[model samples]
Structure formats: structure tokens, C-alpha cells
Target chain A: MVRSYIPAEFIVEVDHEKCRRCKRCLLNCSFGALEFKDRVTPLHEQCVACHRCLTFCPEGAISVEANPLGFKYSHNWSPQLRKNIWKQAETGGVLLTGMGNELPYPIIWDCLVLDACQVTNPSIDPLREPMELKTFLGSKPDFLEFDTGADGTLRLKTKMPPQIAIETPIIFAPMSYGALSFNAHKAMAIAAAEFGTVLETGEGGLHRDLYPYKDHIIVQCASGRFGVHAEYLNAGVGVEIKIGQGAKPGIGGHLPGEKIGEEISKTRMIPRGTDALSPAPHHDIYSIEDLRQLIYAIKEAIDYKPVSVKIAAVHNVAAIASGIVRAGADILYLDGFRGGTGASPTIIRDHVGIPIELALAAVDDRLRQEGIRNQASIIAAGSIRSSADVAKAIALGADAVAIGTGALIAMGCRVCQKCYTGNCAWGIATQRPELTRRLDPEVAAQRLVNLLHAWSSELKEILGSLGVNAIESLRGSRERLRGIGLDALTLDIMGIKPAGR
Target chain B: MKNGRAKINASGIYYRELNRMIREAIAAGEQEIELIGVNGQRYIADGIKQKVMIIIDGVPGNDLSAFMDGPTVIVNANAQDGVGNTMNDGKVIIHGDAGDVIGYGMRGGKVFIKGNVGYRVGIHMKSYKDQVPVIIVGGKAVDFFGEYMAGGILILLGLTCPNNQSIVGNYLGTGMHGGQIFVRGKVEKHQLGAEVGIQEIGPQDHKLIEPLLREYCEDFNLDYNESMSRPFIKLVPVSHRPYGRLYAY
Candidate 1:
């Protein structure tokens, strides 16, 4: 029996009169849902309705219509049944998605609500209240002292190392050159420079075009060690040695030779159309001593750029983080399991590492116990959604936060999860010329700035109600956080007291 | 060689000297020049235009012929990784073993390595009409040989390795849907993708190897007759059935 198919979310529609039959819509559609039948374009039932084609149509022919009424199903099992149908229509396997907050698992954002200013305490106006958003992102000193030089000039002698000052604590994470378009990378870099923060160039070497903003960039050195030269190492504000990524923790990435175009090849310093293979293990690094060698090698190469080591939140991550801190690293970036990726194997992304919340708490507790919490600053990534998560991460001992998926969403990503295909409909993930032109660097940078501004305002509101003015005062202050409806083990793991205690 | 008389003392002085000499020669429309530098400095003769000859004395740094259009760089010593990355047209003759990613993503060029090469040699190489890239590795390669190769010719001539030794490593030609890989030695226990077809080298394959062998012999001082006497194995992608029945219903 043939079943009649009906779509619930018809977020995209096309006007036949306005379509010039130029096939621009077909090229923009990553899902291949649009096709020309007998010279008339038709939208298939398999459309995710991302609205990318509608926005790119030059003739302004596309319009979206909501599903008609009386189409709703009474059975509770209907959503799952419809999802199965959609999955079968697409890959005939399981439906794959990219860059969205996971839904099935309980989202921590929804469980925790921000406390607002009440009548008892003066609720200052958001515009008038002096809120501090300045965040420092480097190692701190243990003791403070003063010394007098021979010239009798009073000089403060302390081991307090310098930190990166951000007007807002939010930063754009490194997504790499091959994963996203150059326009997208430029947008993030420009936005970070404007916002008084830093942007990360993930593993891919710093492109020559981005050299002008070297002071605001954080260059990464990963396992493949692509595009790493003396000039590139010294060009950035900090150097990040990527031990593992949140998307696929142990697995390495392979950028197929077809995607290695001239620009990407030059930026990565590899051959064009050659598979950019990031090896699983760093050949020079076998132990912590070996890791120290690489760290000092880069430091010696670049003359004291703040060196950071980023690792996925795996088993025994606390112990590993301690080793990394003692290995002469200035910072530690911990990525959780639910992080997004441009391309990762289906098996690895689903089941690999621990949650960021638990990992952050454990690492903080371990560092505090070792009396070395001040040796390295902590930056938490992987599924940071709203301003509350940022505040919560700070309370859990994070000096700052890095956002990848959230930043992409602010730049107009629907999270269709087809990033591995390198045909991103929103012009955020692909290297295709026509699709990449859709994302304007200036406009996208504004959207990022706008998102950060809104989040910063929200962060101030939450901090004022908690009776704190600065973010530094809330570092590892778990007394302000209380868990709701959490079990004993979960409460212990999160290191938070239950509500109404 | 007028620029050779100028003494360069700095560490990264080779690239500046090479660029200045090449740019001056090209601006005057001179086609032939010689670079005499034996230092292990980086990025020598990078981004040179088509129709020029650069003879190198000492070892060069990583990315020797990066973004080279149509110039020939003849190296007297061993070179580094990313030898001919994104090179549109040129020839790089190395009289010694080259580093990793040799002929990486090279669309139109000929790289003749007189000795063995490192891992991932000829990775992602392709060819267009009248723009074929040829990478002839004179000795054994390490691993992942021709990985994700889409097009072009990758010839592995096991001239330097001991007898009865395997010329390539595990996962040879992984994800290869196009191009041809010819190995002169026995390929034992190597995993080939389903899209590739392996067979014994035929008479036509010998004809193609003859000219390349002659070029290798002249460049690296080897006997062409001694190199070609051994049996050769040829690898070609199964064009008719690229992927397999797995993707087909």
C-alpha cells in the first residue's frame, strides 16, 4: 500500500512565475529537494525547508505557507512516526543533523532559571547599572609583593601573568578553514576584534588575509600540524594545541582532496585537492614530557605567546588536565561531548565523551585540590546556549567561554546537519563560490555583535539579582547555584546543593 | 647568477634572495637562473611564475615550490613536505628522498623523487585535459599512499628498498575513485578501496614507464634497464562501478 505523504513544516515555497529557471535554487539546496520537471520547478516532500533557497532567489519568487488546519494528529506517537518517514525519505538510514542544541536529553538551560531583582533589593535600570563584563583569560599569581629598584622606584614584584581582557566574556571558537568559508571566518574575526575579544583559527593556519587581525586571533596547532610556520605561530595572541575535539574525540578529520581548493590549500600549506589528514596521534608527542617539548617548541618559535591545550572531556579528564597544566600550558580549553562539528562519523559524535558540566566541575575540584587552580585559566566550550550557561560556567570555575554553534546560529544557520556534505545551504559551512557569496562579512559580524550584546545584558541582569557586580567574584562560587529535582549522585557530581536545603 | 655574489647572513634570507632574483629575471623576461644557497632556510623560490629554471644547491625548507605556476625547481639535496602544493604547471626534480605530501593537490606538474618519500605521497592529486600531474616516487613510500586520490598518475618505483620488500603501506588508495597507481615491487597485504582495480602491469604500462624511467635515470644517475627488468603492478580505479552496490538499492 502506498502512503500519502504530507509535510508539517512547509517553511519554504516557490513562485513559478518569478523563478527564471536558472537552477540557482537547486545549487543552493544541500538536500537536493528542488528539481525541474518539464521546465517547471517542483519542491519535493523531502525538504527541510531551511529557507536558504528563498533568500537566494534573485527574482524574489519564493514564499512560505504554513500547513493548513485540521491536519493535526490526535495520537501522541504521530511525531515519532512522521520523523521516521522523513528519515527514510532522505538517507534511508537515520536522519543526521548538524549544529543545534540537543533536545532528547534534558537541556540544562531550561532547568535553571535566572533570579530577577525583587522589590526588597533595588532593581537598577539595565542602562544605568554599572555592570562589569571584563574577563581575564590567563594564569594568575599566588602571592603579591612589592620591590624597590636601585633608582628607588616602587615596583610590584608578583607572578601574576597577564590575561586577555574581553569587554564581554564570549569568544568565537576555532572552526578551521576547510570546515567553514573564508567569509564566515572573516566575520568572526572582525566581530571579535570589534567586541574586544579573540577569535580562534581552528587548526587551519592563519590565512594571509587574516594577518591584519593577528592581534585578535588565537592560532591553533593540532595533530596534523598543518600550516604551522614561525610567522604564523608568532602572529596570533595565543597558541592552542588541540589534543581532542568535542565532536569526535579520538577520531581525526579527513578533508577530501576534492574540497582542497587553491585558497584552502594555500592557507593550510598543503597540496590542493589532497586529503588534509589530521593524524590521530601527534608523532612527536608521546608523554607529558613530549607534550612539554612541543609546547616549549612553539613558545620558543613564537617568543612567549600564551600557550593553551584543548582536550575533549573524556574519562579521567581531571587527571589529564592536571598533567597538561603542569606541562607548561598557560590555559586549558575543555570541550564537552555534545559539541557540534562540520563533519564527524555518525558513531563517534553520538557516543564519545563526558558532559561539559560534569567535566568542568571535576576539573575545577581537582585543580583546586592540587593548589594549582591559578596556574592555568579554564575555557569551557561544547553546547553553550544562552547567557545563563555562561554565568553557570563561570560559577563552575571557567574564566571565559567559547561559542561555535551559537555563533553560527546568530549568523543564520538552521542546523540542518548536512555540514559533512560541504553544501551548507546558509552559506556558513560550504566552500562553493555561489553559496559562500550569500554570507556578507560586514552584516554577519553585526549579527554576532548583536547576539553578544544581548547576552551580555542578560548576564548583567542575572549577576545583579545574585548581588554580584563582577564575573570574577563568582568563579567557583557554587553556593549561589542550587539543583532542582536532581538525584543524590547527580547533585554530588555537579557539586551543587539541592534546592530548599 | 649575478645575485649569488651578494652575501646573505640572515636565517630567512634565502626566500628574499630567491624571490628578488626570480622577480627581477621575470620582470626582464629572463627564463633561466641559478640559486646557490646550501642553508636549510624555508620557503625558497615560492610563488614563481611559469617558464623559468631555478637550480638549488643546498637543502630547501618546507613548501619549496608552493603555488608555483610553470617553473622548474631542480634541488641538489633533499627537500621537505608540501613540495608542489597547488602548483598549476611546473617540474620539481629532487635528486634525493623528499618529505611528506609530495605532489600534494598538484593539478599540473611533474615531481620526480630520486629516493623514497614520506607518508601520504600524491594525496588528493588531480588532472585536467592537457594538465596532468605526474608524481614518480623512485623508492618505497611510508603509508596511506595515494589516500583519497581523485585523479592523476602516482608511480611508486621501488628502486632503493631491499629485495622482497613491500613498496607501499596499509590502506593504500583509500577512498580513491579516480587516478592510477603503479608500483614496481610486490604489494603484500594492503587494503585497497572497492573502487580500485589492481592488475599485473601490461606491455602498454611498460611503454608509459619507459620515458619516465629515462627521465629518472638522467636526473638521479640510475640504469633504466636495471629498473625496468622487475615485474610491475598497476592500480586503476573501476570507472564503470565507482563506489559499489552498497549505495545502490
Candidate 2:
């Protein structure tokens, strides 16, 4: 048997005078960090800085601070590296984590600056101008056909692909109900519906109550095919085939049988206590041709509704996207390595998959070069942080952008990265009824609406400064962006010139 | 037949036009449809949940009856790949042999194949609550039968094996964690995946198969009692959580 040892990473500083010995922290702490040997003792070793105790404490007498364990830190073997090694050596288990990649990789969205017109081109005032931002996402025909008769009458005969029109370019990414609380999903669904956009019902099955908002919902059919039925397939404006996730590429996920409670059981259409596993690779979809079969199958199911194929942003993402478009996908969603997750193996979340910026640029370039860019719309996901990021994504040729972690932040996620424990004190990611109830769906939905409204306004501000009245004018206009700290390969890949050049 | 098919000659018609005709017919409250000269027309009866019937006189293309609900599809001739793919609450009957990955991820309903099936049949087939999917092939099945099958029933009958064919090919039920697979006659030890173990049919097993066998025989004009008289081998998962040992604490 292996012995256990872990250095403390947080110090709980408490005001004994204010502390009423209530021990609220002890009960609320899901990490088993707080204890009461005598009068509410603080076990700093187990504290993960989730701040559940501090928030729940009535007297507000407790606060946590980082324990500066400044070991002889080598850049190669940093404190994180050493601690991870120690934990693995002792536990003999694969490290599990929640949320997105925390590795301090380059955020290319920040490096590229948005361009504005000053002298030559006149700026349009968003308050006065129309500033059309209505965007329709789906496939488009290569060319339009026209019929001219001898009677001097001309008519256009073309059938456009099915698309969902959103007033704004921001779409809420797929966050499962099991991974996130029902309240969180409700908030997302409500806000998206109110905003005329879609909130993707992650691979989790659609709940019965959420049926009213099906028009604003995008159902996902992953490897597990959980809760998939005729009504579920037809309920959404579009259906997404989740081929892969960005955070943990080539890795399947298992929502433990314990999490399949009464409501989730009904939602996922699984037995009350049964493990739901999304296999790493769909057994039937061994090749691109197989992928085509599945795509056409879904298209046949929903006759006219558009179908999206979601895949991770791996090194071969461009080639994969090309195949998916050829396979008759209406939309292609690329999730970068920094994409959020309910839970994933720590190794794959950090080490696998590529960043979204390079992936988007490469895919756009490849599709354009192949002359099939019009065949499918591209939605870039992963770490879309701010309005600037959205503008830059559009300039990089994305039809739209999907945000998951950002929406969670709007719903009060602290980014403490303990979502896998399902004790999220902020009430965003957890299955426990009491913890989940802490989040108010109505208020959360309002907050999300506010966030999207502010972001939309900010996007208009950027467009106005660029002297453009339509959001479509900004798509694929890489000349409007300039790289600040990006290297030659990245600049070349992103199709952007250096800041000074 | 309570819902007789409204016959439509589909010779030289594009698949999209044929599907359009079907949709229009269904919208007009036609309960049944029959497609003649159906050469490689895909996505027939794809997702109509109403209680309807469709009959195909010729070869149907891939993904026939995909995501279909409450419809009975009968293929008089050979059927291609991905028949009954992800179907929910329906029946797909194929008279001739079918291609790969039949009933992939099917959640409900039944698929009855009167002849042989290609590789990877019943892959990822699952069931939820009272919805149990069942697939029966009259002839032999190739490799990877019931792979990753979380729930549902897959029965392989080797009555039509021309050669002294193996009951099922290699890697059978490779990642299967739930559900039961019954094979007629024999299955070699090497053919079984590590996660699966074979057992002699118990009284309970016999009880489960009896109803299914009776229904299958009646559907395809075979004798149920005679089919059950033959010996059967059942394969069950070694553990509910097949990958339990893979992950660490």
C-alpha cells in the first residue's frame, strides 16, 4: 500500500472573534477540507479554493489565501509538475480535472488588434446607423441559377440550405445538463431563446420541460446516442453530431451511474442507475465515409433542418473539416484545446488538441483553397474570452463563435476548476439538488442576457469604428487585423500581417 | 394489412424526389407507402413517428429507416449498409442480406433480417428504461457483432451458413458492458472479446429468447419451436463497468 502526502496550497485565515463556531464551512465543504476537532479547525491541505465555505459562513469570518510553497523551482520541473508527479506516484491513478486547459499557451486572439478607419473611410455611428448583425448559419450553394425567358422576364431558381438566423453572432456552446445543473441549462436555454440564438443541448438528452425552447436548442448526437428519439431529433432547429471534444481529444467520457438521479435519468433516457459512456470513437464511424452515412441519416431524420458536425481542433483539423463538408455537413464547429469540460483526464485536457486560432485559420484557408468554403459554415469555439475575440474570429473567417466557459462565468462560475466534484458552490456545475438550487434560473438568465447584450453592443462599436454597417463585411477580412507578438508561422497561418508591417 | 401501401413507381427518380413524394404522401394522411424500382434511394421512412408502413420492392440504399419511429419498413429485395441506423420505436424487415453496421446505436424497436449481415452489426446499440432494441439475423454475421452494446438484444442464427461457417467472427462484443447476445449452435473461445463471457442458457435465458424467437419466426415464416429446439449459447458482460480496472483510484 502507498502512503499519502500532499503539501498545503491554501491557508485559511479566520477571525475567531467573529466566528460563532457555526461550522457551516465543515458541512458545505465537499472537498473534505474543513474540520472541527474542537472549534472549527481549518485543514489547509485539502482546500482547493472553491470558496464554498467562505460564501456560506454566516459571520463572514473566514477567507483563504494561497500558501506560497516556494520550492527550489526549476522551470522544467515546476511546482505544478512536481505536485502532479507526487500525486500520481501516491494514488496510482490517472489525474482527473474539470474545466479547460490551464497551460499558459499563447492567446492569439489577444495578439491580433482590430482595425478602424479614421481619415479615408468614414466611421458609422451604431446608434444612428442600421448596423445589421442578423447572421444565418448553414451551407450555401456554389452559385445562383437564373432563368430568362423570351418575354423579357428573369427569375431565380435556387434552393437555399436550411439555416438558423441569430440576431447576434454569439451562440452558447453545448454544456450538458448532467455536467451542469438543470438550472444552469435552463438559464442558458432561456437566454438563448430570448436572444434569438441557440443554446446547444450538449450530448445530454433534452429534458421534458425544456421542450418549449426547442427552437432555440441544438440537440447533439454523440457516440453514446443517449436519450435520442424521434421527438428529441425533431425538437431542435439543428442537430450536432459530436465527433470529438477539444479539451480531451480521442477520449471518451463516463457520467458515473451515481449521477444518474431521477431527473437526469428521465433527461438522458437511461436507467436510474446506469453509467452513460460516450466512446472515444463511434464504433460505426471508422472512416469519413462512415461519418457521411451518419450525417445523411440525421439529415433524413430531420428532412430539412441543418446538421452540424463538431470535432476537436487537432493537428489535422483542417483535413478533417474538409472531409466533413464533403460528407454533407451544413456546419463545422471546431473546438480548440482550451475548450471547457465538465470533466476530463488532466493529461489529455492539457497535452492533446491544438489551439482554436491556428485551427480556424488553417481550416478556413484549406476550405477556401479547396473551393468548398461555401459548402458549410464554420463556428470557432474553445476560449472565446471577450468581444474583441469575437470580432477577431469573424475577421479570421468564422461565421460565428460559441462560448461555454464565458457563459458559465456570467452565471457566477469562479473558475476554481473543481467542476468534476459536482459540488460547485456557485451552482453552475453540480448534480446535488441542494447545491444546484443555489442558482436561480431567472436571475441567471437575466445576467446572461445582459452579458450578451453588452457583448453585442461592443461588437457594434468595433464594426462602427471599422466603418462597416454589416457583420458579414468583416468575415474573412484578415487585412483588418494585425499581429502584435505572433511569430511568422502563426501570422502566416492566421493570414495576418505583423503590427508594423 | 390495416395500412396498405400507396404504390409509387420510383424507377429513374432521384432519391430526393422520391423522399419528397413520400413526405407529401405522408402529409396527405397516407398511412402506407410502397416504392418500386428503388435503386440506391437513401433515407426512406427516415423519421416519421406516426404509425405507418413502407414497402420497398427493390434494393434500398444506406441508412434505410434511420431515426424512424412508429413505422414498419419491409424491403422485398436486398438492403444496403446502415439499415435501421439509430432507429427509435419502429420495425425494419430485410428479406435479403444487409451490409455493415445494421442498427447502429438503435434505442428502440426491432430489425429482422431474413438473410446474412455484414460486419459490425448492432454496434453501439443501447436501450433505456422500457425501450429495448432487438435484432435477429437469419443467416451468419461477420466480425465485431454487438461491439460496445450497452443494452438491447442481438441474436445470430446460423441456419443459412452455406459453408461450415463460424457462428460469429472475431472481436465479438469487444467493448460490451451491458445487454445479452445469443448465438445459435457454437461460438469459439477466441471469437469472444475479453469483456464477454459465455454461459449455458438458463431457464431465465430461455424464457427471454422464447418470446423473441416466436415473434421472429412468425415474422419470416419459420417455426419457433423448431428453432428453439436447437442449442443456444449466451454471452454476457464480465462486468457492468467493463473499463473499471483500466482507471486508477
Candidate 3:
């Protein structure tokens, strides 16, 4: 150690008077922030403030807070920036972090507000009247043709492509099994099965146990093609070609060998303790035509299973989405900058990619303008916090929205941003058996189900208030939305009117 | 050889129906199946977990035997891109040259290409337990051969090429963290990737290549001794975890 200059970000404290000496806090602290030295002692430097010790402490005798050793206040040279500089100076390496970006970027969802029915139009009550939240994700024909039979009965003339039906428009975003614990993956799978929605098997291959919930799963084929076998392609209802991720765009993924344990090795179909690297670009896909080839190849492999192309919400997202739809993608998944990740360079996570709201609006507008809106359904994902965000996403031309961090939070993830260390206290992002066992799959599944149920009800309430009986009525209905604090240019890009107008 | 084999004419037939026919034929207890006129048909024997053998008369399109666990596919003509992609266990014997990105992320299988191959072949090829993937090319290979390879073996034999022409292209084995590559001819340092280290083949390496070359020679109907006459050089990863130290916790 060459004299580390980095200061402790958090300080931990133990209440001696209230401490029962049970020592559960010491066991619960996965980051090694607590130890028994005659009494419960705190290693403030090691503390990540995950609140695991505080939550598990029987007597509620532990507390954690941001370190009060304040630096000279300057907006340009903030404490975090100085700290990051110090860490880099000592390590001479790129700073890595977990979870979503912590930067205070503008959250577009907050500036946009939904319109409710006034006295002129009567609002429907969801309790009395049916509000349809059933969402189908896939390509749809622009028009339907009916043929008259000899018996004078009408039959369908056009052939229908494959579509995936979900009970609600909310889906669980792609979270790899290797990045997250097996129990966490299981919880999502169970919840998706129970909730009648879908969860994506990220770049990590699907485990044998998750085969039972294959119907509700969307297997992803990334640049690495880790666990993507023919059976894995056909295992899920849909196959998602992961072009780019929101957290770290224009980069590849490397699941460190330390995380590649026995089960993950088997699941990923690679040797244990070997780094699994996903190249930045698919080796075969160098152009739009190459992308088309891959999409068609997967379609040929799975036979009619809907294919989704997922890309980060970047500056040319609308045009990229147009090409993807033209390349025969049944669904388009746009992940925005605030999206969560297992591990990424802190700079990339905080700086790369655009907001999902703008990307969704632009893509939807472009597709509709090109008369190809029905060619592929859109799924907007990033920081979808609540049902209001979901409703807003639908109104802005998204057929559905996916939640990654929200789902983890439901399973007791405090977003401590230490998943890169593989010592997650919540048993969500770690592979350590002891830490992972802390999360009970059944309980976590129920909690996730409850969250989805609550959000679905709230979405129904929003639909009833909007005087729309079906959620489909809100799809691309920009008139139902208004910008409160957004500028004129932003409003024009989003295709929404100002608050007063 | 045609006896006890089920034949399907794939002319003007879509890839889906051709593959479906192959699957149906296999399901109906047809051990040996022959596909004629396989012009640009893709995903043959894809994800098929069987022990049957399929013979292709014409050129097959991309992703032949992709994710195939056990079946053996014999292509009489040149094979297009993505041959044996992410395949777990199987054998793809191409009588002619194959296209790019063949044996990508291939876990276990033997792919013998009689002629040359395109760029990025055997990229990200990995292995686990008893599953060690091997790609043997009798002719030259294009750029980025075995890029990002985690495990497995890639053998390049430029037997038919002129001495003036380079056997392998530039950026060879770039970003390779695992696995080994053996070239039967001389390769300049400029052709090698920064992550790759070249050395003379050892006895163990020779032992491994000998059997694989013998099999390749048998498949293409060439003399095994003639294929092994040239002195070989081996390329291995400089580091098992190439980007391990690039980040700070």
C-alpha cells in the first residue's frame, strides 16, 4: 500500500447502551464493516452504508451516516470529484461502480404530467368498469383482410406473426444470473411466472432450474453468445439481441473469473474461473445488413419466435430504431442512461447515453412517420420509478416499460453501489453462498409480485381517470400528456403541448 | 452410401421448412438424411441434440450445426458464415472453404474446413470439463483469427497456399485470454496481436495437433504425413485475464 489518500465515504456507529451483544450485526455486515472486540466495533472505513447491519441488528443499535469530514466547498471541485481523483491517483486505473448513475441529471419523467378527465368528460371507475392492461409485444400487420368462405363465414386472409402476451405492461429488465445471485434470478423468474409478465435472461445463460419459467423468459443473445444454444434460443417466448446497454454504451462486458463459480460456469457453458468477455460489437455484425443477417439467423433457429433488438438510448436512436424495425425486429428495447448494471466504469455510467423519454418519443415519432409503427412494438426502460412513469411511457409511444433497479429494490437491495466487489450484503448481486442464502426466493418473489400488483392497480386507476377503458388507447396518445417545466424545443421533440396549452 | 438415407430436395424451399423437414425426418427414425440443393439455407441441424448424420450436397448457408450437441453435419461444398456457432458438441466437416465467425463461442466440437476461412473465425471459443472445441483449417485464414478466445484450440494449416502469400492475416489472436493457436508455417511478429505470444510447438502441443490433423486429413482425403511435414508455431495468451487490472474497485 503506497499510502492511500482516499477518505472514508461513510461512518458507522454502534450504540453501546442499546447493544445486547448478540453479534448479529457483525455477521450481517458482508463488507466487513463490523467486528466483535469485547463489544460491537465499527470499521468506518470499510462501511458502504448498505444498512444491512442496521436492518438486521436485533436491538437497533447501529447507525451509519455520510462522513462529516467536509472538504472545502467548491461546485467545480466537489468532494466526490476530489475523492475520485485521489482514488485514481493512488490506483492509476479507471474507477468502477455498480448500479445506476448517481449524477443529478434531469429526469424527464418528472417534467411531463398526464392529463385527467374534467367535468366535461366523465371518467370511468376501474373498480366498476374494466380497464385493460393486457399488452401484446410483437410486430402487428398494418391492415387485416377477411375472406368469405362457401358457408358465407368470414375467415382471416393475412398470416399473423408471433406475439407475446403479458398481463401488464410492466416487465422485469434483463439482469444476468452471473451479475445477480441465483436466488435473485429465481425470484424474478417466479415473480414473472406468477404475475403473468416476462423477465429477460441477460447475457448470462439461463440456469437449468429456470427452464420451468421459460415461457415467461426472454433469452438474450449478446456479442459473447455465452449460453446461447439452439435450445436456449427456443427456450423463451422471445429472443433479444443485445446491441448495447444503457449503463456503459459502446463497450464490451467482462464478467471477471472471480464471479465465474461452478454454477455460473455451467450456466454460461464456460470453464470455471475464466473471464467471460462480450465484445463491444458482434464479430459477424459489422453493418445494418449484417445485423439483418443475425436477426434472420435467430429467427430461422427459433422459428417464428419474436426477436427484439435492444440498444442504448443514444443520439441517433430514432434512425437506429428505424433500421432495426426494417431489419425485421418484432420488438425494440431502448434502455436509457439511468439504467442499472452489475459493474461499469463510473465515468461511462454517469455520462453515456441519452434519457429514455426523449429516445422513446423520437423513435415512436420516426416509426409512425415512416409508416412502420406497427412493424415493431417498443419497450422503453431506464428509471421507471412508478406507475405514473409507466403511464407516461405508454402515452409517449411505448407499448411497455421495464424496471431493473426497481425490481432489485423490491428484493431488499439498498443500492449500495458495491456490486462490483461481489460482496453484496442483500444477497442480490453476490455469488457467495452465505450472502446469497440471506435472500429467500419465495419471499422475494412475493414482494416483487406485490409491487407489480400495486403498480398494475395504480396504472388501472390512471387509465380510469384518463377516461380510457383500454391501455392501448393511451399508446402514442401525446395529447394526453403536457410538459410542465420543459422548454419549447424539448416539448417539440417530445411532441407534447405546454402545461397551460 | 446413399442406402438407408432419407433425401430431401431443398430447391426453392425456405430455410424454416427445410430445417423442419430435417427435424421431422430425424424424429421419424431416419438415421442418415441427405439435403440436396441447399442453396443459401440457414440453421441446418441448429440446436439439434441428436446422434444422426446429415450430408449436404450443395453449399449450406450460415449457422450450420449451431448449438448442435451431438449430430455430425458433412457439407460437400463450401459453407457460409457462422458454421458451428456456440455449438456444444458436434462435428461440422466442410469439404470446401467456410465463411467468417465460424465456431464462435464454440464450447465443444470439431470443425474441419478443407479450404480457407474468412475473418474472425473461432472468436470467443471456450471450453469446460471434457468439452474442448477445435477448429482446423487446411488453408489460410483472414484477420482477427481466434480473437477474444477464452479456451479451445485453433489450428491453421496453409498447405495449399503459395509461399509468397501470407498464411494468416493481421491482428491474429487479438484480445485472446485463453486457448491456443497453431500455425503450420512462419508468421511475422507484426501479424500477431499484442495479447498473443508465439513460440515453437512443444511435444504436448504436437501430440494434440497430430491427432486433430490426422482426422482433418482423413476428412479431406489428404495424406496425414504430408500435412504434418511443415514445422509449426504455437500462439498462446500473454495473460489469462487480459483486462483484469484495467479497472479500480
Model 3 per-residue lDDT tens digits across residues A1-501: 476787888989889999999988988899988888899888788999899999988898888989999788898999999989888888889999999989998899999999999999989999999889999999999999999999999999999888999999999999899999999999999999999999999999899999989889999999998888888898899999999989998888989989999999989988788888999998878877888878977887787789999999999999999999999999999999998899999999999999999999999999999999999999999889999999999999999999999999999999999998999999999999999999999999999999999999999999999999999999999999999989999999999999999
Better of 1 and 2 by TM-score: 2
Question: How do the predictions measure up, each by TM-score?
Answer: 0.69, 0.95, 0.97
Docking class of 2: medium
Clash pairs (backbone) in predicted model 1: A97-A417, A98-A417, A257-A273, A272-B105
Chain B TM-score of candidate number 1: 0.87
- Model 1 residue A67 CA deviation (Å) reads 6.4
Instruction: TM-score chain B for all models.
Output: 0.87, 0.95, 0.97
**Model 3 docking grade:** medium
What C-alpha lDDT do the candidate models reach, one value each? 0.75, 0.88, 0.92
The best candidate in terms of lDDT:
3
lDDT of 1 by residue, A1-501 (tens): 555354544445677777788877777777666777754354555466677777778998876555443436757656545655654675454333455334366555455433444676665454676878898787777777999999999898875675667888888887998889988999998999888889989987788999999878889987665666456766788889998888788867666566678888788765566566665655435689767756754654454558999999999999999999999888899998888888776556777788888899899999999999988999999899899999988887888889999999999997767776677777898898877898999999999999998899988887887777877767788876877777788779778887776
Q: Cα deviation of B232 in candidate 3 (Å)? A: 1.8
Better of 2 and 3 by DockQ: 3
Error of 3 at B234 (Å): 1.8
Better of 1 and 2 by DockQ: 2
Retained true contacts (fraction), each candidate: 0.00, 0.59, 0.73
The residue-level lDDT of candidate 1 at A4 comes to 38
Sorted by lDDT (best first), the order is 3, 2, 1
- TM-score, candidate number 2: 0.95
What is the TM-score (0 to 1) of chain A in model 3?
0.99
Deviation in angstroms for A236 in model 2? 1.5
Chain B only: TM-score of model 3: 0.97
